[model samples]
Target: MAPASLLDLVAALPPSDGWGPSVATETTLDGVPYAPYSKADKLGRMADWTEGKDRERGGRQQYGNRNYRDQQVYGANQQNNPFGIIAAEEEATFSVVDNTRTTTRGRGFGRGGGTVFRGRGQRGAQNQRGGARGTFQRVGAGRGGQQQGYDNRGGRGGRGGRRFGYRDDKPQRNRDASIQVRPDWALLEEIEFTRLTKLSLDTPDGEDIDSYGFLYYYDRSYDKQPGAKTSEKRLNVLERAAYNVTTSSDPIIQDLADKDEGTIFATDTILSMLMCSPRSVYSWDLVLTKQGDRIFIDRREGSSLDMVTVNENAADAPLETSEGNKDTINSPSGLMMEATHINHLFPIQVVQESESAKRDMPNEHPFYNPAEETDPAASKAYRYRRFDLSLADSEEALHLIVRTELDAVVKNTISGEDQFLTIKALNEFDNKAQGSGGALDWRTKLASQRGAVVATEMKNNSFKLARWTTQAILAKADMMKLGFVSRVNPRSPNDHTILGVLGYKPREFAAQMNLNLANGWGIVRTIVDMVLKMDDGKFVLIKDPNKNMLRLYSVPNDTFEDEGSVMEKVEEDGDDE
Candidate 1:
């Protein structure tokens, strides 16, 4: 082949024009600013659930659902919301002691009392919580950002202040572990939210109480290296097009909940769910065509369509060919891998890219290399999902967790016939005509109830979605119990795997089993079909049809093939080990 001529390239060039007519942001909304706050989250604040009903009395104030925990709060997620308040069996009372007699009996009675010295200079001194009475020591009258009388021994959590950095709000609850009462919410600075635009309450500049609820939300951004410049090509798992997915209960979440005391444990999964766009286009290449020098490239964009056409015709009309005269040939996806060039001009490049990469469950076990493996402390057996109190629509966030801790709490807290068969029964336990040994413990009730408001709402669709979430988690958990887990990424000697900007290190979240996109019906679909024998498929996942739930097991027909029976009792506790 001879080298292409410069004149040939010049003749193949297509026409170019400036951008089309402009449009302005004023296409819809008024120029005036709306109160940034949307009253959506507060819609259900007064709902019966908020009142710690059947449980101890606690504060209730609902906020916008989609907002960060600083704004997104509901009865279920809020630690301070009456439900989580574990009341002490004995209430404390304070009484002042008479000290005049003691003073009189002292030398003051016999000798004349001396006049007190000037004290205006030291007037700032005061007891922190209560007066130091009798022989007992009291909280000092002064301690910056410290709780007063509440006998809290735990370290100040989070930011250690009120919603507006106010440590001044009266401490609501606290006690040493011996007493077992939870610490004050006002002290858990981590849970507090400052105004989006303001740093301190001392300044009355930016947003107010209402506007604060509408602060920053998760935008599904890419995770670049600490100092690396932001590139459009980099994307986290949730932002990609090949079916991005993640279970809501990240380890980062559990750390926050562990520290939370009456403060809201946020449930931002729904909004994160919305972040995974199904029709999302990850990337595309620019097709540069050349015939002789008459190159033609279609610059027009149709957002919904996948391909762009490029023709090399120099004339306005298509070339008169025997087969047909057409100026169309759509660009194919993944063509970047294809090698077709005119004089080595590499202009057909990937132009658009997703901010995140899609992730799937691993097909095998031991998530990390020999040196890097499960954290040993992270919850691997049963995933914990914190479902939001408010509801929203989501197609990608089809993830679910078994609420292992909640199940344990329910089984231990409520025994025998009192056990709930349905979520409604558990939720309605508060309204029972006969109060069962006081209120049925609101914290227990909220946690016990599978408040999958959105996921469970579509009972039919959730079955399959739940199966994938369950089976994969179960498999990983079982592997973990056996001192191994799925390989999260390809293993190397140092346990390093290229994890984008975060680098080739251990993953922060639970290790997963990938279900690739190539699996005809999708990974989750394939898992469900095989597990449930759906569509008359082979039954690998046993169905415990006691309830409508399609619980999984290896043997479909065995009466004792439930996950608890087969997976745990037989496999985990086999006694061979």
Candidate 2:
């Protein structure tokens, strides 16, 4: 049978009122028996998608949905007719297959799915990479990165895997776990500090000590005296941290404050816990003095400080030389010691109350817990700590130190140098207070009044940051020594080599350590605080290894027996019903 043309079918079929042209899907035009739909003009016509049609091509029942002006309705192809007309005559058809299969990925339907015929777009051709290539490109390959592997190893040779050109099936390198995340040092070998030597401290044979090379000097009196011990207080494991800013104190600070002569100071000795040998240590007496918003920190030795004492009367003063750097705290010798301005380092506003840790049971609560508001998201965990330079401020600030200020603390010549004048000044400044510029000395003026408490806190963090920065560096080195830095074929220690994996050089670490000498206290604070938290990890159970005492310990998940700490902790509840 032959297919009947739409014109022949229209003439032969009986008229149906109201509805438009109706043609039979399968009807014999002659003895050959052919279908009229094969050649029907209606193949290119449109129908509403919302209208449902019966499987036999009959219309579905729709109530009050007809448009008298235009017969548009819904869903003519609901009964599985893939080739149903879908758009008005004005709309072009869309082809799923484009002529260039590798290029344009034609989509949707031909009409308002609206693609041009022959699988083309109204605009232009696609790029060689299979995305639109002109003024109005709908898709572009640039949206996605190149379809090539990223070789981070900086090697010219192809890597392994079918994806990589090489046959080896392993990654170039495996990152060692963040072993610093644990107090792995204590668990391994005994970590020790290089004890400081006096003015006789040696510099490498060829290398001269930076005028500000770490003045590593030991003090028998200070070492024999542990200054002040961190008060034995109940510390909540995750709720509170035993940081120097809060718990630790240097003897210098304690002595100054204990005078009760309105003398206040801050120091960074807290870090000695991790750095000094056997956990007993103190630093080269660095003291912070804050006057109003202005802050100045200088290292003053024991003897010089001993000369300045609280006088009951002006006449009772032992050393009363008037007017000069010596007469004032600014002695040429004193100036030769480190001195520079410090800035506020801690951002106290970050403490969110709800996120603050709490104990299920507390033996003794802290005397001061400053209350603060919390957001819904912040209450979940200790997520507020971000130790990046993102928050650091740049000013007199974070910038380079002044050259004159440098001359003061750096002493253009060191003790061993051939300069006789330099050695004389250093010796004279060592054991005695030169003089007082009477009441007019800047030191006397600055120390006369109490300063904002923040000054004290910032001063405290300097030690905290210094202590931890050094510790973090050592932890990396220790991790390398313990075979964590490199992997080997044989699981033996001899097969591996200790390799440093830190992103920074030792010099950079040293620079950061000295950053507290001038500015960058807050930045150093944030970074060191973050590293210390990581070094200690989330568990408590901290200890002074040399003393063999525990401050806090983590509650083991596998056991009910609680850890015994040196300090009192929240005991487990005792209701055995």
Candidate 3:
């Protein structure tokens, strides 16, 4: 007979729901029924039977039986029964079983429903205790007689206790912390100017005068430090003669007071002055002292100080010596008059026009028209005759410095350069406690004390403005030069011109540009202005509102040339065919 193929044998097997016997079968030899002595003996006989069946069925039977045995053993162990325990371990090795007697129903009985112990080549129905029920009761004992039971207490020899609320420990402080400071000097300057306006009044007579004019000097000092306090004080002296001549009860004066109740000039306009300089010092001398504590009061000197005349004899002498001996010298007429007067004044004023005349002219008036004109001859004569005292050399000039400093601090604070305290310091003379000057200095001293605090504020404002400006530039970069153009449909003459110049149909442009109502109007205005320019400039902008896709348009001229190339040749050939 030929051996069966694996496929044929598989085909011969019963269906999943059928209970067919295996291909290989077992029968007792000599017509005697075979029996197993112990539980181990039964398992050994089962393994042998499986091996023999596999040999006859071409290994199929053995594989199936082995799988079935594995599943049965696993299921029995899960039940935690004594038979399951024996099948798991000792049954696979030695044919061991337990045969013992116990009292049951008030009678001594030998093991009945237990395992049968079988020797080699022996067969019997001898019953014995099976698996763990056998007489071997020391199975789970350890070296120290420790027993494996439910209530067993021992050291941590098994699984460790579950970990509870454990976490990593770390420090909480940062070593590299620092603060940033940015100064917004420009904004500060604007704020300072605005504050000055609020503190003064406009005159009905068209004098654009403010309390600041009455101030001949202002001085302030600031200290630059972290977290410092800011302090400011101003000293302003009125032109005494002007104040005395003007009536205190005048309507203009009363009106000004009412308008600017708390300002520097609210109480007395004659002596009122708003400190507007950003820095502390204003100097009379530009060369000797770059920065000083004084600003000179009174009118500015012009070109009259540029030249000096002396007798030929005294020309060679020093200025001081020449002036001293001029009174004793004889003149051309035999009269001892001074040879010359030294022009000690500085030329501070270039041209002086009446303030009222400047006010009358429109800001955009043409250059050809006269805003104001002076007689050249008369102007030259006045320049030659005008004389001024040497304020730079006077002791009173130094007092202007303190007043200037106070005004500058106030001005800087109002403008937004809160950080002025970080870069400025009090004047040296302010240290001395002397009269009203000392009091003024004391007021300004607070600025230096609070410099650091103001500086921090300024720095923050600067950063904010910078960020805002950057965003604005980026947002406007592409359309900025396009001027005021809109994406609206042609409802007006301006709309038609804009659409014609852009070379896009109104609906198409509107959809592609994604322009809002306001933005559409702006775009239209921009294009109109660009068209008005004489340049043959082209406007190219992105058409894809979602992305940066570009569309370009050129200004139309009467003389524009158009030419065709390879695509035209293709069209011509197609037409002929």
**Winning candidate number (lDDT):** 2
lDDT of 3 by residue, 225-312 (tens): 2122221112111111111112122333334435432111111111111111111011110001011221111111121111121221
The TM-scores of all predictions, comma-separated, are 0.13, 0.20, 0.12
Q: What are the runs in model 2 whose C-alpha is more than 4 Å off?
A: 1-77, 80-253, 259-497, 500-577
Ranking by TM-score: 2, 1, 3
How many Å off is the CA of 168 in candidate 1?
12
What lDDT does candidate 1 reach at residue 411? Answer: 19
For residues 1-577, could you state the per-residue lDDT of candidate 2 as single tens digits? Answer: 9998776776786766767666655655456433233321223225543223221123223222223113322333244444445688654453233354435543333323422212112212342112232122233233223222212221211123133334456332222221112333223222123211111211111111112101111111211111122211111112322112221123323332344322112222222232221222111222223333222233322212211112111121223223222343333233222111000001111122322322111111122233542212111110001112222343312111110000001111246321100000000111123221122211222223213211221232333333433433322211100000111222221122111111223235446435322123332232233233333222222333223332322322322123343112533333332
Residue 557, model 1, lDDT: 29
User: Residue 478 in model 1: shift from native, Å?
Assistant: 3.5
Candidate number with the higher TM-score (1 or 3): 1
C-alpha-based local distance difference test score of model 3: 0.21
C-alpha-based local distance difference test score of model 2: 0.24
Worst 10 residues of 2 by lDDT: 419-428
TM-score of 3: 0.12
lDDT for residue 212 in candidate 3, whole number 0-100: 24
lDDT agreement of model 1 with the native: 0.21
Q: Which candidate should be chosen as best, given TM-score against the real structure?
A: 2
